[model samples]
Target chain A: MESTANNRVIHVRELVKKFGDFVANDHLNFDVYAGEIFGFLGANGAGKTTAMKILCGLQRPSSGTIEVAGFDVYKQSDQIKKNIGYMSQRFSLYEDLTVKENFQFYGGIYGLSATEIKDRTRQMLESLQMTTSADMILRDIPLGWKQKLAFSVAMVHRPKIVFLDEPTGGVDPITRRQFWEMIYEAASKGVTVFVTTHYMDEAEYCNRISIMVDGRIEALDSPAALKAKYNAATMDEVFIRLARAGVRSMNG
Target chain B: MRIIFYILQKEFRQIFRDKVMLPIIIVIPMIQLFILSYTATFEIKNTRLSIVDQDKSTTSRALISKFSGSSFFTIASYETSYEDGMERIKTGTTDQLLVIGKDTEKKLSRKEEASVLLVTNAINGSAASLMNAYASGIINDFNRFILEDQGPAGAVPALIAVQSRHWYNPKLDYKTFMVPGILVLLVTLIGMFLSGMNIVKEKEKGTIEQINVTPIKKYQFMIGKLLPFWLLALFELMIGLAFARLVFSIPMEGSVVLLLGIASVYLLVVLGLGLLASTVSDTMQQAMFISWFFVVIFILMSGLFTPVESMPAWAQNLNRLNPVAYFIQINRMIMLKGSGFQEVSGLFVALCVYAAAILSIAVKRYKKTA
Candidate 1:
């Protein structure tokens, strides 16, 4: 399906991925517009990671036409890779490296100049209010700061889209809130945020969300629209309603 | 190029920062160099001997005294019977037994060649060979002494004078032979273990995923991963060489450049093995276990503790695939025998081939995508 939105940064249609006999992703179709916080939410093994991996060009789709950041996934994966950034669920940063060192490394790998790396690292540290911890090793820092730092490093190259796979898996409520604030801050700067999360409450923060159940997207709409369509008062109830109905359909 | 530097810097920092790994990389090799160089030897010392003399002759006693006087043999016991001496050999009380037949002295006086039976427990083949040589030398010396005593009244022309000398090692010091091989082990250990675990640690911590998403090409990433350990292994070789020179006084007969040149390529082969191991394993423990198995096998077949020429035919054939074996040969040739580049070119070319093959395989096996 052609994206109806004016600015469709990610247009994935009929995407399918298989691992031998098991289908990890089944005919996933979605349009994520530019400058939007798009939530790809699912439970464990619900294929959120599989689909996100395909989008990020980390896995080849069995069948699909995925155009990410204006580059085809099949023929232009290198281009797609150059235009996107990724943060995995485990908060992928070198524990032995200092925060400034992590920033310099990520920025350097992305082809930033020495001056650019120095400037960006300085700005990132100042923005995170981590100037005092500039030389502190990542393992010594708190988990919340590390999560935020991971995000900041991912966008150091100013890519067209950024993928965050469960950016806030284990953190306190306030830190999670602050982490989402950084996501909002990035999206506000015209960087499309494609995030995956299992947290139902976190799903409410996305501009539009897709709830996956058993390799299929069961619900794709705004949080209000999903609640209204399922006749539920919250995103959590909407998720349960769709997930249960999905299981019933599979069984029937 | 810059990306490679970043990766190299990160790896060096992590390698130096880990408290446990730092000591293991630096201290273990040095300590092993000292300990293994001292302990691993083919020199036969204090070989226990048991004698059973049935003739009760002066000649028999003279032979026994000759053996007993040598520093290599100790007269552990004098059994009354051959069966008792055999029993002593079985019980580990003695390594060898000499049984003198009853007619041994009578035949010698009658101008007939006498016969005596010698028995040895040849559990260790190399040590047994050395023992045989030492015992034979003593018996020959006794034979000459008897010849002079019997025929000195009339002057006789000597038969022949056979001049022999050990060339490279005149003293036949086991330390000289062992120290170079131990240095090869130090390089192999550092090159394989450190490089293997470095890649696997990123994988275990999920940092590899972050690296995979970057624009770092496969070869660039691999070179970045391997370069630090290669240099580090060379640094280790330098230290080990210094220790060999200062402590063991092993001669550095060949050019230092030639040794480092072979060592550099040899390190590539080992570091490539490490990267290949890392690519196949999912965790640091798995990487370590896999590399450890290969390291032990390679070191054993490497002609370090034993000559590769002396191994079984199939094992010698297998050494063609072992990089450590080639390196041990190269190091010993350069340090001990003063072999030049042209002399070791066959091994050098084989190592170059191995380095290329293993590194390319490592690069190909490392999956940037899931």
Candidate 2:
């Protein structure tokens, strides 16, 4: 892990995002190393999604020097988009399309050859044990299966980084565990995972996590280290301590 | 280019899979064409006429026979009193009243003019005017007949005659004029609504975000979004043209290829407008309302139901910005008059410029980042 620490996939310096007078991400600074699962945790409207959007090149920051997959978010956003994959919580896959068709379409747009797409699609379906359901329309599938398929489709292009925005929001805990396993597998293959979530238990699965409070990162380190520093029993307690401080600042 | 191909493939698949949308794209326009072409017309076949004949003479009887014999007027009743004839018109039972004055023949024989009164229901202004024209024409023919009969062969005063001929449509079949214009309308409807709703649907479904985050070029995505509807609209125009030719037997005097070429360019303008509407709107409902607002304005001002020549000068000036008006005019000229490319070259250039301008605006407005 120490040997791979020098390979920085995401670098941010003094990132400031303002929607009118309200700053969504204020002077944020962070770096995500290669093959690392970086968890972004925040309560609702804490600006986690906004920060993730900026990192994915889905939005332009009001002011920032940010980079994703070694490409500058401002100048090389198109190149950054090519190297990164994104899946939102809104279920972005086409419900009318079949599982295999979704995979082929996402792969094809990324300039993958037809045979390569077919091979990867078959491999993905077989691994997910969804081979028989490949031809089934996506709308008929269960929500958990759809979530899994969306993540796999996001990886169909073999992007260097995958941005999952609340990828397991509505899924069962068992399914979320499986989702984490998939994320770990991708990370093992040197695909950096940038995921945002509300579940503190899920944050424990990250090698290192950042807890954002009121548009700023209040704490960022390994979950065990954050718990130890806060003198808390679990990540949940650490999160509560930081979030209460954010609440105090709001009232002040 | 390959990316565009895949996007088109995905879009075509989704469109075909929607059973509700498929029929709307293909069947509804044809139904509108068949119904509107027949129902929306200017030809007044039956105008009920009542006669108040006070003069019981050969001249008056001959005139009554003239009104009854003509196909334009159906004599609803014959009354002794003028009030009774007018009552038929007031009650909506008759469209016009023809009153023959007393001693009309006696006055004509004395080489003096005889006056007859025609009271027309001017409720519907244009229809009333047409009925008036037909009645006056028949009365003129009667005067000419009386002149030829009463005077010596060469002693009749010489009068300048106006022989009017209706060209392009010799028989003045209304469908020949209407079908081309309606065809332009249906094509515009399909192009504008489908392409506009399509992009907004992707936005609503959150699929647009997925496509946006990809490395796909903006032009490639736009082309993918628009080309399928463009082809579908052109195909619809072809089917409409075939229906026009076969069912109505509307004369296609112009080159089919030229009409289609012009239609293709016109479709770009319409499709671009739809795409533009999609970019500004978030939901399919908003896009539909925006499209409806524009479509209603364009259709009314398109000269489809009324002649542009008769429109107020300000409206005519405003119509210079109307793409539908330009295309309908081009369609009528080509299909009815057999106009060549050279004849419509100026309008063709205008359409080209409009297409380029509208499409670029749509492209520019569609923000990938947003």
Candidate 3:
């Protein structure tokens, strides 16, 4: 349980969330270590977003002991916020603002000073090689650039942990590849990355992957180990084997 | 608290960065205050009058002179007959017409009664009634002048004396009543527009999840969200009231600070209702519709346009739930009656209760889908 774990950055135990009578997280338990790309892979409505929401402190668990960055979920949430960055599927950046303005606004909300926002924005824009388009409105930019910019804004405050919910949902394959390169760069700097996606090819990039089905995680292991155990040629086969078996087990 | 300031700074930057919100927040309110204060007045200042003198005699000429000398009526034209005076009224060139009959001198000598005609445009019922009263009173005083010195002791005067005095507003200017009421509407509009769509817009854009993940406490976030609008709403209130004082010449008999203090709570309730509406609506359109619904109801029962006491007893009692009703009472008291805290305490307490209830509903419903 999170109450006992003092080492994990995210410690979720018996994290049950329900909507009316339908359980979204049923006695869920998981822990994420520091500086690892933890992949949360699931089909639609498999509670991946729900579990991520609880970890991020967006939603309260019906009855559970959960902790993020070693702070209790029930209290001391602001401290956790200082250590976290969140980018949801909706691209949590102001579209009307220029790329530079989005960075400044989010940076300011994270308690960065004017100098800090400016300095971080410059370094991040330079790294993205997008210095010339700093003044271009976000809506005018292509989806590929916007996705990358969203990730940079999430990482602006240099939070210890960052959550990306479907961060590369609609980008082209080449852009998605470059997007993972940015994720790798952040991970190499000892920043923990918690990501949710349904992209089977993308799961192999994770240090460890958890495949969830029907409000529960059916399989949690390295992608290679999952493929090997299921005797499958790819992560897609491994996901299908687990998803089908989980559904069968539920009906039986 | 520092974080709240950070959010406010970001919100202001975002507000200014957008093209649509700037005009809605500042420019529109100022324009409304100016136009409403100057135009939406009850005290009739400029009136149009036409005189039809049938006699053209000294007595009729003297009476015509009295009409021209009066401040309320401007001598629009000279009419030779009553039919010509009616033409002036029909053409909309004159608001009112006065007809003096041909036998004015003979009637006074024989001591027989004489008649005068007053025609007013009845479209704007309040202004027309007031103009009619003012014209009749002035004419009656002129008829009494002719009778006091020249007529027989027992002769009946052609006009009746109706000595009247204005109570609160001695000048009876339309601007005096309108200025304070417009101030109430301005504060309500500012409060409703800002808080009404903020949370829902955040949700639609998915920033609610971004904020949710942070250790931002619910009450802390609520205070941060509502306070900017509360202060902004107060700023709007001050602007509207200042315009009322300067442009409309409406005097505040009550303490400004006390009025501001009570008004702040009413702003909170209005803003909280907007936040509560945001919680229920997922889209800007839905939020807008919900906010407008309550706005219409509050304005109808607000007592800014009509007298609350004149409404049915049940309707009057139902008005107690409306924050605008309380605000209207406080505004009129401070701007008109000039009363202090003791006079407005009942409304103040009611607004506080409404604020608490509305804020709680908003906080309880402010949840991201887990």
Docking class of 3: acceptable
lDDT scores in order = 0.88, 0.92, 0.82
lDDT value, residue A34 of candidate 2: 89
Structural similarity to truth (TM-score) of each candidate: 0.94, 0.94, 0.77
B1-370 per-residue lDDT for model 2 (tens digits)? 8888899899999989999989988899899989988999998867898898889999999988888899988888888899998878889898999999999999999999889999999999999999999999999999898999999989788989998899999888888889999999999999999999989998999998898889999888888999999999999999999999999999999999999999999999999999999999999999999999999999999999888899999999999889999999999999999999999999999999999999999999999888
Give the number of the best model, judged by DockQ. Answer: 2
> What are the per-residue Cα lDDT tens digits for candidate 3 across A20-77?
9988877877888888899998777788888887777777778998988888877866
Model 1 lDDT at residue B239: 89
For candidate 2, the per-residue lDDT at A84 reads 91
- Top candidate, metric lDDT: 2
C-alpha lDDT (0 to 100) for residue B225 of candidate 3:
80
Q: Pairs clashing in candidate 1? A: none
Give the winner by TM-score: 1 or 3: 1
Steric clash count of candidate 1: 0
The DockQ-based order of candidates, best leading, equals 2, 1, 3
Off by over 4 Å in 1: A1-6, A245-252, B55-57, B102-107, B153-161
Clashing pairs in 3: A77-B215, A78-B215, B41-B174, B42-B174, B43-B173, B43-B174, B253-B338, B254-B338
